[model samples]
Target: MTEESENTGGLARRTLLRLGAAGGAAAAVAAAQTWAWPLLAQRGLVSPDGAFAAASTVFSDALYIEAFPTSPLILSPFNDPLPVLKALAPVPKTVFSKWPQPPGPGPGQQNSLRNERHQVWTSQVGLPDPIVYKINLLVRTHSFTTSQVLPIDKDGRPAVSFDAKRKTYAAGTKRFLPPSTIYGFNGGFPGARINAEYGRPVLVRFENHLNENPLNLDRQDFGSPDLSFLTHLHNSHTAPESDGNPHYSMVAGPRHRGYRPGMFVDNLYLNRPAGNDDGQKQSFFWFHDHTMDHTGANVYKGMVGLYPIYDPKNGMDMGDETRGLRLPGVRTNNPDGSFDVAYDIPLAFTDFRFDDGVTIHKDFHDGQGEFPAAKNPATHPEWWGKTFYKHFPNHGFVGDICTINGTAFPVLEVKRRKYRFRFLDASVARIYEFKLMTSTRGPKSSASLGYNGEELQGQYRIEDGQQCMQFNEIAVDGGLLPVPIKRDSFELWPAKRREVIVDFTRYQDGTPTTKGDVIYLTNVMKMPNGRKWAASTRFSPDPNYKIPLLKIVIGDTVPDNSLVPTALRARPPLPSNWQSLLDNRLIFEVQRGSAGGELEWLINGKPFDPFHALPSLKNPAGRTPLAQQKKGSFNLWELRNGGGGWVHPVHLHQEEHQVVMRNGKDVTRTPDPGHPDDISGEDTAALDPGESVILYRGFRDFTGPYVGHCHNLSHEDHAMMFAWEITP
Candidate 1:
């Protein structure tokens, strides 16, 4: 067909499509428009889409610990049913499953293992509602000749130091687990729960044992033995040292890094030189290996975990220190007339796929077209996978299945009282919605507090603070963003912590019994986002990624006598005046491009390719002049999207933004959506895309080393990136 004729024909078809869609309701048309989902998984290449990987290769050995607390292991100590094993590479692919429940036993039990390598592990961890984590990190260097090995001590755990000579790793084009790579927390790979309370600190030791050569990953964007690594603490605002600023990276071999915690913070030190600092906030967040080219490899192999900071002054006991009521209604106190509530429950929700016996770390390229590693053979001496010159690219094939708390279809027992639940969307490219069902089959209180879509903008009336100021200059040292959630009640978001009260007094059996209560936290987001999420389908679907997360259970049920609590976490002494300030700002737009390319999630309009660095955020020009905004002032932002794709967990680097306005209105999605789906309040906003939702603001404490990006690990590492610095 002639170019003009083809264009004309395409235009005509699209017009007809629109006309037909218009006949339907706006929402239906919008939904239908996205129904065309691009043709991403088209290429005739071998894609790992609906596949399965080998199970974990169990590796048993009591990691000898010198320190009393056992000082953590390289990966093991994994409990039964989930024996920590080193599964051989290239295992078949398989999706993860969520059994048991999450927030379980904190560490080893937090997440499940589902591989899309064509394989992965699935399990669950049990924890009291809201849990916090402080992750330490180390990045690995790759070597082609030798399998970039992460050595362990006598007992069978990654040792701080290795017994063999740390040879200079041979460099190879960045791909998944290609020998040596730098990543977050403990070397390469991720875990179940990588989130903490709203504001917390995370400390990591990015030990560069191999003294990686930049040429190893990318000749240009490389690190030194001092090859510093910046940690995004994914979604928090923390101290200058803590902010994941590429500018603040330092020597890893024997260095320690520190950071406070809060929200809307930046990761300025992401790839720049270290020894300096960028002011920012710290909130409930995670830390991942944030090096250039190597990020994909490091993160996929697992290098992420929760990082949070906190003050114990305010007390309530779901699992906290103080004591209070059980459910969500009334107000009571200890012998001392003080309101009380339960500790927020944090559920680190992440999905994985395993292939063969290898879990293609999320972010590792699938060797599909586009980012195919250089086949020069000369450039990479130790390159393996000769048949096709394989390399783990900066992304992984979507996996299938879901898991929570380390268990598949896991269950938890909760009280009829009030409880706080915090959720984290740790999936690679999955958009999720939630649904709480009745265990009428069992005896427990139904959910009163429901789900909230605070992230979506342009649905309801908006309550806000201010826009990101280009001006205001308040030196943030190390504080937190505690933007009061202005609602008649509570709300929740992915990676969000909410204090909710579930009263069972009415459904209670009149008895002085002491049996525990059990509740299930089902996932409806999987199906919704599956059909609703926007992806170009640009290339044919990669087998691994398209899978479900997992189901969860709420446990630790209590009796009516000392059950439901009067208050949730005690308010920080009823704010006399609102606090929390924004030192600077960064707005990111996540979306998908045409077919043949992976879906896109960009900051401004750029991706973070170490090879193709993003535009200079530093005084960016060439575009419309950026308006000078107020600093030290609360800012309001209307998070808008391109629409027609899956959703993303947009996390800020320096401040905790309260979802005030959605769809130009003020409506908050309760923690419970309930029967039918009541989104009546003005605070509720469901961003179908192209619409703006205003999220009110508070303030940030310190400003140095921060970032604003997607919480979805894959996007964060692949490209969707930006920085927000509060220059003193």
Candidate 2:
């Protein structure tokens, strides 16, 4: 998609309507390639206007990097992220100080200036071993090892990395190095992971260092207030003060008019079980930027990382080959000559786009309002370093590039044995339908007509290419399932985590599959609209959306010591007296706004007003949150989806719920097509358009504010979120 394709051509409404008409998946795809692409070309839906528009090749060109292979499972030396958070010199007072500054003092201005915020712990898990971490948010640049020649700017200067021996920044040169500029935690993209142990407490002190960024910010069009900090550890059981609620955002700079500027917040997390039962304990969680209305931009800039809780008593310690369920553990250097690597891995899935092929897009910021091209000429023009649709696109940000664990098209070397991979969809919007298939080849760098899902179907289709392996489901968002479910392919929505055991020793046919064999973890869901793929869309034979994520090459045969247990810890079953509790059911509706000049994603019909909760039968004043529950009570929460051609992966903070019913039917073990398990006792649920789900959620132990909202960062940034409190 070139700048020339930005024009919306006159493809009559009738044609666009027919493209979505009822038909077989093949017909729909044929219509898309035959008619939709052409119309979209005229309309310029693919190519955004401006210098910073994502390169058309991002969508059209197939990924082709092979070296710089292994995906890094970001683990911190300590359980806390604070050690990595260091202080940088303050920005020199100058003309470019309009962007907020870190409050307090300059480098040599004051001797007493220091971060003052502290945390006070309440509950304990097993033991009270507390660890503290200090993390800073800063803008920096780093080289992403890739094979594609970084695209050159208009001046013919290379945008890629420079030769290590010689580094120079010269215009119009074939050999210039320009690392991707990004906003990151501790200046590291995909910030460090926290290996927290159950029963131990962790405290993180977050400081705002964005003011020290060398980049100019006055000319940006990013949504929400700039230079603010609100770090939220998603799905953690913590107090409201540490929950990272939008209302409690701390802006950088000096205090003003009683609203004092805050430079830091020490968040305390009690890595304890949701209840006395082991099933209430959570295993996988991640922390990211949750600034009021700017979550999408901040997170996209790389403020995300993983946090896996290890409970020795709960079989979380895979390192012990003798004790517990000795699953493969993380790789570790051993004192002996041999190595000690846990085939257990973590994959954080994310998408990013570089303006050309190297300089990543940076969003410009405007105040908290939509900037239309007609009214805002200065900010509307697509420029280098901006998203395709300027500030914020209502549809959601789905990048053309797919990155896992910070690498693009990387390869993983696995032993011929069972391994556990924790997959987390960190994409802002894209929903992935993943499958494992035998090797298939296409042009390494050919123009792939993105979204023509049916075109390249035959070769990679499972029937043509053998089904390589399957995933034995072990855990969901909050924690482990009651029983392990097996599946060929699984779908993961943003913010959802699925942990599975994959054995490379045996192929689908139970043949002795081993070394030299190659398989790809690929995506098949045809989602060109940043929403759910339509029902008529064919996913099986879809080649248009077929993109290999990780290439797994079977290596040497390893000792088989690990085993997948028949069952995992069990979550509390639905209250046996549910019929008597029907009268207490509470409903929340997720909807899109009708006043549509600009799109408004909402919960109920209102935009987020953090201070005001929508009025409900339980809260007559509407001022009270939707549901103010007693700390230990179990309540049936009904989530009703307002039909609007979207699937919302609804996520709730602090508490994990058990699905009681979906669409008025009792939740059962009957699995959906690719998902071979039951959807129950999960923190996040995928709510389809026009569907309704009833869940049993318990508000126990800790008390304070929490939220339930669409995990879609774009939607969450909008008003599709609501707050509730747990009373003591």
Candidate 3:
């Protein structure tokens, strides 16, 4: 059979298994009764429930098993891989410097110098010496659960081992499952956290060590084929070379691929705020792989890390509750050169699908002949329970399991005081709307609740009758808001950051939260497929559907001094005549193109041309370049959604923007109730269906090619992105 046909067959088999588990014929009848029945019938293999459908037809002979249950309160601070160095012992070299006169211009071209355009400003500010850090990307094993007991199988037996001898474990067998392989930063999951300050710049030498794999694990069919990498500090204001965009990696190239194995690139981050304005100082940022056409796979493999910048100049110290906005935190410097802030936590939400030990590892690349298919789909019995990823998911990929800080279903203990929580949606396509909830019935198993099939994916342990709790939202992806806004829940899209201060001392209703009180961090957004949210708090919110992600237990009260001020940092003023620039605005529309499957995502009816190698889209038969802007120039740009029933979290690299108009409505003059956060400066433009936003942005300080694309990594990797250069 054709690979495409086999793909469909794979989905059908998995669907049948789900149907049987949900009570066989009765469950199918009930599924047909729902409103989604028609859509499900049309798409035979796609799950009506919000779980991933198998993309491979071959099923493993090994028995089906569930994820081993993990204990609560397993959340702990991750260790920094290496100590922070005070000085650069050996001067870092660039790709260009390594090979003076390399090859032809393509992927190997180097545009900027080691320090690039920001060196002058960095020195002029008389900032302290830049901190040097060495980080390596290599393969390692990570455990999702800490359970020692082997998970039970569908036949009431411990899952059979993948060993060639075919040994089976007895019921209630106790043993640790094999860890899944991951390409991590510094050879660890969640990478390393860098606690930085605005005045202290950072220089990171990222060395690619992906070529080494001592474990000899089956390196999956996803990720960059060449094992090359390009690291982009999402939303950071820096030079193009350090920005890690594909435009820089492929330009003026001697080595037209990415920073390959054994090569190192020095990324200099000038922590100074854009335009030297304190209001422009960002709070949280992350760095991850942005290799052309392989971002989703690379990130899914675990190349993600965190960077939280503190504004010490304005009393907004790192964790001192007595100063600045007095947010919740107590700073602790680790002897291992790592840093931690008590009461302040960064939660990265990611999802994943594990190998069932049955389904074959198949994807679009395999079908397209870019990679060879497995000789025997069921041969890799050892892959059971490990993370499974598909390179090209037409509807976009969303995981069946939810993970926080690299651990699945983890719980945190909190002191009965205010705490600062930084939320990041690191999933490939899933968009999460989170709410703090209190449950009277406590946690229950999904099997007991009659949830089966893919529905049982991430909702293994759920809370009963969850009630909402309110919190004070203090910041967003850009930085602090003009003022703190009280919210019961908020939507976090891919690559978007939302900071909230939750006071554990008392509930929203003024009831005191004593020691041992348990609260759950629940996700209310329902996305059956990555196309869009089936139900969201913003539009069609489903009150009954709540999936508890992280558990929180209250402890004894601590000394309270943090204050939620009425006035936070002031935003830079926009020109009164900002509206005048709208007439000459650069308009770009993101929409589905005429192509099928993996090639449909497009910007202005054109796929991204990273090398500027394609013909211009302006020509009748061409589809190349999309945008360009002059350096040091301020202009208005409009991002429009070419309605395809999909929502897009559009991200623009390099600079944050001020939204003036959304859907032709002047939000600057009047607030948008649907999007209250529009008042804050943002780097991402969250566009709902049939929406368009007009932003006032500056292309300043440096000049080079950057990217603006849908933050949905699946959409981005599939070509729903465009390149725009800042001309000098």
| Candidate 1 local lDDT, residue 509 | 35
Model 1, 355-452: lDDT tens digits are 11111112112212122343221122222211011122212323232334332233444444443443444444444443233333331111111212
User: In model 3, where is the ten-residue run with the lowest total lDDT?
Assistant: 54-63
Residue-wise lDDT of candidate 3 within 1-728, one digit each (tens)?
11232132233322332333333434334544464455555667455332112211111111122122211111221111112112113223344236452211233222222223222334656665456667789889888767442443433234443432334444454555467889988876687777877888877778889999988766766677668788888888887777888766666321333677877676778898777778898899988899877899999999988887888886775677888778887776666544577777888888887654545554435533344434432334556557777765656788766888777767787888888988888899898988888888765645446655444545444446465568689889889998999998889989999999998888877889889988888888878667788887877876656787777888888798888778788888889989777666777788864322223477776666665522223322232333677777887878888886888899998899988999989998575887888888888898888999988898877877788888888888767777778887
Where's the lowest-lDDT run of ten residues in candidate 2? 64-73
Q: What RMSD does each model have against the real structure?
A: 20.1, 12.1, 9.1
For model 3, what is the alpha-carbon lDDT of residue 654? 89
**lDDT of all predictions:** 0.30, 0.56, 0.69
TM-score for each of the candidates: 0.46, 0.73, 0.81
Candidate 1: regions farther than 4 A off: 1-229, 245-286, 289-300, 307-311, 314-345, 356-398, 411-421, 436-519, 527-589, 593-601, 608-631, 666-687
lDDT of 2 by residue, 178-203 (tens): 35556677777677666666766666
Candidate 3 achieves a global lDDT of 0.69
Candidate 1 accuracy as TM-score = 0.46
